[model samples]
Target: MNLTGGIVLYAVLWFLTLFILLPIGLVSQEEAGEVVPGTHAGAPHRADLGRKMLWSTVISAVLWGGCAWLILGGVFTREDVMNWDQLVR
Candidate 1:
């Protein structure tokens, strides 16, 4: 993959990881019994975004490294995906 493709892949992975990690271990305001004024009870009591972001970066890096290796090592190619329907025929 080119530089742009690699960057895009990492960005996608990062966001996906972040979203997946967002809900884990979260305590809703209702559960915590401290719903802030005008905020929904379902809102997080402590989002802890900084920690999640750090974990996201680390997870994305490992995932991206594996994907980059596969792409660069010729384990698969774009043509394989584009022509995937034919393989099932």
Candidate 2:
């Protein structure tokens, strides 16, 4: 792929990743049922869930960036057609 093609692919992948993750990241764990309404902050599970969500968001961002880099670097490519014969030839 050419440089422009790579950049386009990267942008597409980055946007897709952000689109999928932003909603979940924006919501708090308390709202997601990680913590019961009456639960105290001292509860381990409550705190753990919040931490997990944070880490998940960070990891997802890093992964998305890496995928964009790979796409732009031509390390990955999309198939032109889905049919088996088209792919074989």
Superposition error at 43 for model 2 (Å): 12
lDDT of 2: 0.57
TM-score, every prediction? 0.91, 0.36
Leading candidate by lDDT:
1
The ten-residue window of minimal lDDT in model 2 covers 41-50
Q: Which stretches of candidate 1 lie over 4 Å from their true place?
A: none
Q: What digit string (tens of lDDT, one per residue) describes model 1 on residues 39-65?
A: 999999999999999999999999999
Count of residue pairs whose backbone atoms collide, per candidate: 0, 0
lDDT of 2 by residue, 1-89 (tens): 56785567556655665555445435455455576568653343333444555555566667767766776566665642235467667
Which ten contiguous residues of candidate 1 have the minimum total lDDT?
74-83
Whole-structure CA lDDT of model 1 = 0.97
After aligning candidate 1 to the native by TM-score, how far in Å is the CA of 45 from where it should be?
A: 0.3
Clashing pairs in 1: none
